[model samples]
Target chain A: MSFVDMLLRAEARHRSRLCVGLDPDPARLPGRWRGRVEHLYDFCAAIVDATADLVCAYKPQIAYFAAHGAEAQLERLMAHIRVVAPEVPIILDAKRGDIGSTAEQYAKEAFERYGADAVTLSPFMGFDSVEPYLRYPGKGVFLLCRTSNPGGDDLQAQRLADVPGQPRLYEHIAALAQGPWNRHGQMGLVVGATYPQEIERVRAIAPTVPLLIPGVGAQGGDAATTVRAGWRGDAAGHTTGPVIVNSSRAILYASTGDDFATAARAEAERTRAALWV
Target chain B: MSFVDMLLRAEARHRSRLCVGLDPDPARLPGRWRGRVEHLYDFCAAIVDATADLVCAYKPQIAYFAAHGAEAQLERLMAHIRVVAPEVPIILDAKRGDIGSTAEQYAKEAFERYGADAVTLSPFMGFDSVEPYLRYPGKGVFLLCRTSNPGGDDLQAQRLADVPGQPRLYEHIAALAQGPWNRHGQMGLVVGATYPQEIERVRAIAPTVPLLIPGVGAQGGDAATTVRAGWRGDAAGHTTGPVIVNSSRAILYASTGDDFATAARAEAERTRAALWV
Candidate 1:
């Protein structure tokens, strides 16, 4: 199936816009599994089992595993999902960007190594930096546009006073990605929920491109506002595609106790309720 | 010894501005070692043996190893260097940028896992992104300011219209790195040698900070111009203190024949001689 179609179906089946982010910071992991991969796997597996029905996708940050020198474990973790939650989309949260050959290597790593359904890319290197990933059918690429952090405004929001019309850099990136890089239509924009205004503006620019909305839970973004601002209000009036709301810390670290899975499920249910309403 | 002092001493003793880049692209490896770690080890060891005296530092791009699922080989490659050329500074070429917590993990990888004297950083997330690496004493942090690629100018050279008096984005980054982020004075900038004019401008902005000049040889940068633009000019306008010129593919892949080491050594010696004169 096409990446978009797959996402839409997943969203409908789950009746949820929630995306569980598996950002396993070892320091924050509960109980005796602090540095152990088995403990990490158990924790992640339990969470997946509990919240699988509530989320449309699960995003595993590659750095977390690479940090542990447990690349093999990461492969195992992804393979386990292939067996367990085979229906849910897996978006590997690796913000990689490079030119030509190097970008190809990263594309292979995210797609071939871990077998992620979609991958987050750093569009800082321009459109070609994203082209290699598009070659793979049924895979999606999320380009960083308006980020969630405070300092995101530093370079992203910087305007070209020297240029004629004074265009914001992020808008230029959005236009370029939408125009040329979206040839395969598998491209998406990572518009952080923290900036609703930027989200609305970017949505207007790249109306068809999907928006991977991160920073909802731990980053303190309001779910309703994000959906409303991000939702496409075209001639269809009630827009209904290309936006996946993501929540990481709130669901992943719901409980430090042995009943962590139960707590995670509760968190997922709460987030699902908050979104569906 | 402190990273800055060690860099200075290494530069003086080597009597060459060369910095060899160890980017062992798996696809580009010889057919004999087509699909194996031992082949990578042999290739890297040969390069180190041939070029240790000709260069001040060895830079290994982490992406090449990470792409091949040769994470174990990365540690082995660095250890190989420690055994062969212990005095040659190892600058792990990882353009890592993340939040405070994640940045610490990257530092541990570059410092503890690979045992690099310095690591190149991508300053996309602002000061907080690089602070974790700088906190470690006797370690060098070379932040990406202006890259050599065509599209690099898209964002790095952006100017804010609202803030008319503000410096170009890269200039602001250079200043910030030199200011608060330069805790140990071990901070440096990776200003590509391709941009000689920008190199001169950045040198003025970051006069005291060390510069890691890449883009020589295969990248089409003139060695003489790079040395003049980066180093200090005395009364007779002679170049001075701590600048390492890097050349990767041009030397390492100088030959695909059995005399590959001899070819690599010849290329390194040629590059070294061209820069000094």
Candidate 2:
């Protein structure tokens, strides 16, 4: 099945738009796993099992695993997710961007090595950098647009003078993802949940593509505002536009004790409830 | 020692500006190593040993290693470089960009886990994304400004209206890298050699920051034009501004025989000579 089809199906089956980010920071691991990089798979597996039915997707940030040389564990985690939450798609939040050949390697790493259903990318290198990822038949790629950080304004909010009436860098990315660059209908835009206004604008430009909205829980974005701005569906509950709102720390470390997995599930349940529109 | 000082020292010691890129693509490996992922380290280590005294720096594109799930081999390769070429700095060509916290993980992956002397990054996420890496005192960071890819024109060439004189996006990055972002004097800009005119423009805007220029051999960038545009030095051969011209495939796959490493050394010597003023 296509990535979008899997996402929509998972969303409908679970009645959730929440995507739990599996960022296994060793320093924050609980109990015996605290500061133990070896348990990256163990810690993340428990959380996945607990929230198996509460999320439409699971996002594994590659940097977190790579920081501790835990990619083997990440591979194991990907397999574990496939077994425990088979319908839930995994998006590798790698944010990779490169020229054609290098981009192909990253695309392969995301799809073949880790079996990610989708991947996140930095759109800085432009269309050719994004082109290789689109070659994969059923995979989806999300381009970073209008990020939540204050410093994001330094570049993302700059106006492009030569483009007709002038659009901000992020809007240009949104338009590209919505139009020409998204040839296969497999492209998505990542507009942070912290920027609801920008999310609305991105939704206006690219109404139907999946928007991977981060910054909701620990990053302090309103869950309702994000769904209201990006989610579009029919009265019969058919989602034409999808919003995958991601919350990492708030759910992962709801309690930093031995009941971490249970606490994570409770938070995921609460987050899912909050995001249900 | 600071990464810049280390680079300058290496450049003077070697009398070369060539930055050999240790990108080991399995299918392209020579002789018995053909299509073998296990020999990633061996292939790269051989090249590094052959060219250690002929180049100022070594860049290992992370995607090439990660694609094969050979990151552990890359770790061993990094260690091998330190043992074989202690003075030559290593640049981990990651192009990583994210929000603050996530950026921390990537920074850790590059600096702590991989022990890279420097790391390449995508400046799309703005200052906060670039800020975390700056915290590592002696290390250096290179931000992608004007890339070699044709798709780079899509974003980097766009005229930013809000900035005075409608400077292009890459020019804006050049100004930032040369100005406030160089707080610790540890920042550099990556301006591709394929666009020599753009390289000159970046040089004129930034003036003193190191320019990591890729796309020389296989990508068809002119070595002489690249040097003329970015390299600056005094009569005594003391470089105030440095240009690290990188070549990967041309040297790595110079021959497909058992004498691959010797051919690689010959190519590296020729490349270093071509870049020499």
Candidate 3:
């Protein structure tokens, strides 16, 4: 199935658009699940198990696993998620981009090796770096449009001259994603919830493309504003758009104490409830 | 020492500006070393051993190793490079980018775990994605600029209105790297050799910043044009500028027969000799 259809199905089943980011920092893991690589796996598995039913997808950031030299643990975590929550998608947040054959290898790594339903990519190298990921028709590729960092304005916010009316660089990217890049209908844009205005701009530009809105929970982005700006409504005025609001640290490290898993579930549930409002 | 200093030192010592890319495709491996993970290690080690003395650096593309689930092989290969050719730097061509914490993990992966002297980064997510890698002042960060691929034109070639004369997006990126973003002075740009004009343009934009010029051998980029456009000379007219010309398949799979390593060394030598002109 296409990512959008699968996402809609997951959204319908869970009645939520929450994407729990599986970023397991060793220092922030629960007391019992700290230090070791096995514990990392256990911690992420626990998070997935605790909140699988409440989320549309689980985003496992490749960096946390890579930092510990525990790719095996990541493999295990993804496997566990597949077994426990077969319906919920796995969006591997790699943010990888390269030219030609190297890009193809990354695609294989994310889709074939890691079994990600979707993989995040950087569009700096333009279409060549992204085209390899698009070869996988069943998979989804989220191109970074407007990120949730202060340094994001360093380049993404630059105004483009070639574009009519001189739209910003991110707007140009959104147009590309909505146009030629969406031939397979598997493309999405990552517009940060922290930048509601940019989110609103991107939403208007790429109307139908799914928006992976990060920075909602721990990053201090207001969930209500994110929903207001990012949430697209159907013709009948129902807010049924494919907008995934991700909360990593706020949900994962809800209580670094012993009640981490329960707290995570509670936070995820509360966040989902808040999104509805 | 910083990456530029180290790179220059290596270049002067080796008397070459060639960067041999160790992108090992399993199907393209020599007949004797076709399958198995150990063979991949052996293949890369042989390539390194054969061409180590003739090159300034070795760029190991992460995708090839990640595809086979053989990151251990990559680690071994990097370790082998250290043992055999300690003077030559290792450029881990990961092209990784992400927001904040995630970028930190990738930085760790490239610098600490892989022990790369430098890493290639995609600037799509802007400065935050590239900043983590820059924190290590001793290491080098080469931002992707005008890529050699046809699809690169889709975005990088778009003219930006932010600059005085409305320079292209790549030019804006070049200016950024040459200015504020390169505070530690460890920044560089990856401008493809296939587009000599773009390489020349980037060279002019960022005069002193090192350029990792790829697409030389296998990608049909001319070496003479690459050297002419990419090679920047000091005011004293010495070719001491940091411009690395990379050749992957042409040097790697030179024979694809029993004499693979020997052929690889010969091709590296030939490519190195060509760069001098």
Candidate 4:
């Protein structure tokens, strides 16, 4: 099945559009799971176990695991997720971009080595940098469009003279995504929920492409505004678009105390409930 | 010492401006060393030992190691480089980019876990995405600008209306690198050697900043044009600018026979000599 089809099916099965980010920051882990890289795995496993039935997908940011030299642990976590929550997809938030041949290796890293269903990519090098990842038929690739960070305005918001009416670079990227660059039907855009206006603009530009909306929780994005702007409905007024809202630190470190797993599930439940509006 | 200072010192000591990329592809490995990830380490170790003295730096593309689930072997190769040739620097060619907090973890991954002297970064998300990597005082970060791929023209060549004369996006990035983004004197740009004209423009925009010029060998980048357009000279005609030309497959798999290491050394010597004039 295509990534979008699988995503829609998972969303329907879980009755949620939430993607819990498994960014296992060692410092923010609970007291019981505080020390080694092994603790990192335990923390992620506990979060996955607690929130598996509530979320549509799990997003693992590769840097957190890579910082601790824990590729094997990450692999184990992916395996654990596969066994425990087989229906939920895994999106490796690696944000990897490179030339053609090196990109093929990264495609192998995300898909073959780590066994992720999708991966994030940076489109700075343009088409070829992202083309290799599209070769995998069922996997998805999310291109960073308008990020939630404060410095995102530095470049992504710049006006392009070559574009008609001098549209902003991010909008230009959205148009490209709607046009030739997305031939495989597996391409998506990452427009942060922090900027609802940009989300609306991106949604208008690329109406049907999936948008991995981060910044909904710890990054201070309003759930109402994000859902109102990004959540497209069918003609029957049902929320049918692929807007996977992600909550990373808010859900991962809901309570640093002993009841962290329960707190994470509660937080995930709350976020999922809010998205229903 | 800063990255530029160390790089220039290495260039003066070795009298070479070549950077050999350690992208270990299993299919290209010699017949005897084609089995496990340990063989990957041995293959890279042999290449580094053979050509470390002939080049200014070694760039190990992270995807190749990550593809084979061999981060430990990559770490071992880096440690070996530190012990074998202490003067040469290692640029972990991980084109990583993300928001600020995630960028910090990637910074740790490159500087702390991998022990690389420098790293490659994608500047698509702008200032903050590249900020965390700048925290390490002595390390280097090369921002992508006009990559050597055919798809580079897709986005980097777009004209920005905000700039004075609507210069191309890559030139705008060059200007930014020469200006505010490079406060610590450790920043550089990756302008492909394949496009010598773009190299000339980038060289003019950021005269003193280092340029990591890839695509010199198997990518079909002309050595003569690369040196002529990239190499800067002082009033006395002494070569002064930092233009580290890179060749990966051509040097690494110079001969797939029994004398692969010897052939690699010869190829590195040839490329290094070509960068002089």
Which candidate achieves the best lDDT against the true structure? 2
Model 2 lDDT per residue over A121-230, tens place: 99999899999999999899999998999888999999999998699999999999999988778999889888788899999888878999999999999999889989
lDDT of each: 0.80, 0.92, 0.87, 0.88
* Decreasing lDDT order of the candidates: 2, 4, 3, 1
Task: Please give the lDDT score at residue B97 for candidate 2.
Answer: 94
User: At residue A232, what lDDT does model 2 achieve?
Assistant: 70
Q: Interface-residue RMSD per candidate?
A: 2.1, 0.6, 1.3, 0.8
lDDT of 4 by residue, A80-103 (tens): 999999888899999998877889
The TM-score ranking, best first, is 2, 4, 3, 1
lDDT of 1 by residue, A108-214 (tens): 88888778889988776566667889999989998888777766776677776665567686776677667877877888888888878988888877888888898
Error of 1 at A202 (Å): 2.2
Docking quality class, candidate 3 = medium
Question: Fraction of native contacts in model 3?
Answer: 0.80
Weakest lDDT window of 10 consecutive positions for candidate 2 chain A: A231-240
Instruction: Report how far residue B65 has shifted in candidate 2, in Å.
Output: 1.1
Encode model 4's per-residue lDDT on B1-277: one tens digit a residue.
6677778888889998899999999888987776556688999999999987898889999899999888999999999999887888889999898877789999999999998889999888889889898889989999998887888988899998987988899999999998999977878999998878889999898988889999899999989789789777879876535989999999989999889999999999998898877
Task: Please give, for residues A1-277, the per-residue lDDT of candidate 3 as tens digits.
Answer: 7778888899889988899999998877788766665688989998898998999889999889987789999998999998999999889998887867888889999999999999998887778788888899879999999887887887788887777988988898999999888867889989888878888899888888899999999999998789889876668876534789999999999998889999999999999988764
Backbone clash pairs for candidate 1 read none
Evaluate model 1 with DockQ and give the value.
0.52
Clashing pairs in 3: none
